[model samples]
Target: MFMKWKFFDKIPVEGGVSYQDLAASVGAQGEIVSRMGQMLVSTGTLLQPKPGSVAHSRLSLRYKTGNSNGSAFAMLYDDFQPVFAKLPGFFGKYGPNLPVGKTNIPITFASGADGKLTPWEVFAQQGTEHIEQFGLAMQAMTGYLWPHTGAYDFTWVGKYAATNPNRTLIIDVGGSFGHSLRANLVKYPNIPPGRCAVEDREEMIPSITKAHANDPVMENVQKVAADFHKEQPVKGALIYFIRRCLHDYDDNDCVNILKILADSLPEDEPQARVLINEHIMTDPPDREVAAIDIIMMTWASLERTVQQLEKLADRAGLVVIKVHRAGGSSLGVLECKKASRS
Candidate 1:
């Protein structure tokens, strides 16, 4: 809390600020902020360059407020205390196993919406801020922190777009605020915005529309109000891209979602694609991957491996063609095609 309130990228690197002053800046009690600063200092997250004063430590520099520290943005996902507290009770009601679907998870139960509403629904009911925070937090995870642009080469899509200007080149399903589409436009101006589209839930469509209302970059980019759980309304697109959304669902739900895209593919073209972009955990699961996997447990979701994704694709009547991942990227694109026409 102290780190988010004060250390947000605006802290001075060489000078120490008094805890009392820092607390005053954030309108908090002095004694409490002082205590928290001392605790952070002990943990090497803050430095006592001088007595009674604190400065950003080597590790805490990234936590500066205005900066895009994905870790910091994630810590703001919500008050997770209640969520973790409900874990045992949630399991007791269900069974002692990893969660699979969207409903009745730890977060839903903690929010007092278990079996009544999904987390997204719960967030929507709370207010716009909650939903917006969740969206920005997720964007932080995939947009800035561990961006997929580096992991996979998308410039080739631009080349493809140039030749096929009128074809539906990409459809980003469940894309929030059309970030991916905007990104593609920036990278490859050859991409015809009119030929691209973003499909999301009904409630979220307004926000997407508002975001692109006056933005020239997304002028002609199409927006569709659609649900991935149901059949994909947009058909025969060159790229049916689902980015960072499947992990929100379980194996069965994921298979169903993938099947819709597979069913919508242009069989004769053979180039129509179903690309799933998400983190693919290593076989042994590295520290970061393991941590994210646990975080996903909040909603009974998971960070899957390529092999696991292959199984899910096969179940969905899609065949995994290849997984594209560059070195140092935390996410990958699972290139897929329809398993069979019949």
Candidate 2:
């Protein structure tokens, strides 16, 4: 909290400052700042090259302003902290099994709307700053950990887009700031511009546009505002790419979202695909994946296994075609198609 709200962020990254000086700069008590500084240093974040003097360690440098990791820190401080505080009571009341329907852990505890609103809605009510910070945090988390192009093969999609000039290539559902789409386009230049589009909430359009304003890849990437829970507006796109979206909700809501995508597929185009990019839990669960699974519980969601994804796909009237695992990473690109009725 001190780092996010005060001392750590205020101190110069290159130079060392005494804890007392740092605290004075932020109007915080010297003793409190000293304790926090020592904690950070002990944890391999900040460094004290000289006694009583603190500076940014290599790791701490990542959390400076304008850095994605910095945004992540802000997100942790502003968003998750409150929700996590309520976890004990929530788990005690609800038990291990999460509630069905739209009521989620974050909604149950963090929402002021009497468990009526989703986390996104709560963020919306909090205004733009909250939304922007969340977006940045997501960017930092994904960009730093997973290389989107390396994670999934977009060659086939690019080839299809190159050949089918009239058809849309990729529709990034809930794509914030077009980061995933932009990354794919950068990797696959053969995929023509204007053939790709991104759909997000209406409030996100301006920020998305501004985010991609100067990027040549996004010059042709269309940005549309639409709710995912409602019927999908765009139809017959070669691929509907959803990354880190479904895990935000429970199984029922996941089914609803996938069903809408499935329903939008062109009847004649059996080849159209829905690509889901998420962390897939393994048998000997990766420690990080396991940790995320528990953390997602705070939002009434979980990191699903392959079988779990398949079952969820089945419920949505879709068939899981492939699970493309990112090499040496827990992230998987699960490919699905509309289930055939014989």
Candidate 3:
């Protein structure tokens, strides 16, 4: 709390402690602390306070508190308390790769050319990584912090699925395990089971499949093992759901991924819609969500502006037909169709 409070309170202006002073305060000890410090330096959480000092690097962030719901301190506490609570059990049994051991690399969302991790990707990757490292308890922390419950993402995606009464084939690209599809199925209860297909890395298949052994809905969902960089196997898919996937990669990679999908579709297939579900960064950054911008930086991803999306769509031979904001949600639904020329 002391370090976090100081970190949130101080500023590196004309007068500040040297790097040496900062290091001393933290009590530099074993390899773990060193490694943790290195991560902080790399993630821009800690920096050189003065010329040749060896203390903890001086750190500062411009933040204000006092909101009705909670202050910044409250938010940080609320966000991290759960993680800290489960740390012993999750880390003790699972190992140290989870978010517990002060090894977290803060993400900085890059919208510009500087190139960094987008907020959504940071949250998604970290959330998924947490679950992978620490098991179910860590998953709870992720579920709590990110895409927080009652935010309307799953509900709306289910509604979208419901609209396609034609037994439309839904391909969930890069869908982690079958979590999203399963959630959507619960929302659209009437939707048939056979219409859902999830594509992910080969390694994730067996584990995810085993985890869903008891789920009756899992029978209908096909798990396809393929790389997103290659051509999409299912042609003329009714809807290609790329939720929170693109932002994990840079522009060139996204274009390549989209090209593969575009090439797989029949040019005349009107049912083919590329649905990109992501948190579109507002032009003027929203301060409330600003922490995410910094989070993206550590991971080499970005939250793009609307213009960026359009340009990327044009390059991929897709036309942005409509942009629908998910009701009471942070993510946007970009409905795209193949371009006439492509």
Candidate 4:
């Protein structure tokens, strides 16, 4: 039903679309369309004011054309679902241990050319539309939470930028589309122009540029293409901000990513910080956090607790200075700095 009619894309948000009209547009039989429409209505995705016509529900509106939430749904349904289907067999063979090296479930289930690619590589290979959709989905996922400003104060960084003549103020490593940076710019407009930079894979630069082209927030934001697994190129940045990026890798990779960032900080500059924005799993975990933990497991990544994060930081020669939790949400800003050599 999702693929056939592009129901979410084609249906008008303000009014109902008839089942017969939807079926004709998709070239599907009327009876089948009716059945699927009824099923969707039953699932609360659509509302049936009458027998043959369906209207958008609040839930269904999210998947409308040009909506990031819809893009996210497409990424999960079209891309991740196949990997999920292979999980039972994957666990049967690999014993449910976190996949490492080349034992990726997505690759295992993927056909032909994609069978050999890592999840990141696979996304890169799919071209621009796929990458943009994935990014939009990520933004949609975090839209419910408090903005990044609410979680981490940028005033200090702005002040630091004002005083520090030569130093980079912020480097958003693995930051896709500069959403967090854009938000920061909106919140703290005084942050020095040309002091902030965003790094992602080479494929993502153009899209990032286009995404923030019109916004004054991104006017001075530098877009650099660098792999996060390697040493971060821009050095001595006062703040290296990583939001929702580390949770995509396993523990070892997470340690390495942090270590590289940690190594880049100037030893004399104690104020330099690495801000990690992600979900900190609760003691009695919330259902949303628990559910996402399982989803992240598909890629062998995970959401970390405060203890887990601390350990990860310690392993990377960094110390967790504070964990700022947003009120009424599972998100946290884990502030870390280089461990003092005592």
Q: What is the alpha-carbon lDDT for the whole of candidate 3?
A: 0.56
TM-score order of candidates, best first? 4, 2, 1, 3
| Segments of candidate 3 deviating more than 4 angstroms | 1-168, 287-289
lDDT of 4 by residue, 1-342 (tens): 564257777777788888889888878898988898889899998999887999989888777655777887788787777777777777776676776654445444443332376777667767788888888888775556535568888887777777777888889898888888888788888787588898988888998888778877686689999998997888888889998887888899999999999999877688999888888887798888887788777777888898998999999999988988777778899999999743
Give the Å shift of residue 228 in candidate 1: 0.9
| Order by lDDT, highest first | 4, 2, 1, 3
Clashing residue pairs found in predicted model 2: none
TM-score each candidate: 0.79, 0.86, 0.55, 0.87
181 in model 1: Cα distance from truth in Å? Answer: 3.4
Tens-digit lDDT track of model 2 for 1-342: 654565657768678888778777768888887887788889988888888878877887667655667888788777777777876666677676664445545544665453577666678888886787778777775653655667778878777765667877789999888788888888888888688898999998998888778888897789999889998889888888999898887899899999999888777776788888888888899887887676687776888988998998899998988888767677889899989832
State the number of backbone clashes in model 3: 23
Which candidate tops lDDT? 4
Model 3 lDDT per residue over 1-342, tens place:
323334323334444444444445566434444455456566665554544321233332322121212233443353344444544554454455422111232222122211344333334355543333222221222233333223233344445557755544678888766565666667667556677788876666776677667779876688788779886777766678776777756688888888777676656556577877666788576553355543332344567777787888889988888887744455666777888643
Ten residues in sequence with the least summed lDDT for candidate 1: 66-75
Residue 330 of model 1: what lDDT? 67
Candidate 1: tens digits of C-alpha lDDT, residues 127-197? 76456555555556455446746554567777887776667888989987787767767877777788889
Alpha carbon lDDT at 313, candidate 3: 80
CA lDDT, every model vs. true structure: 0.77, 0.79, 0.56, 0.80
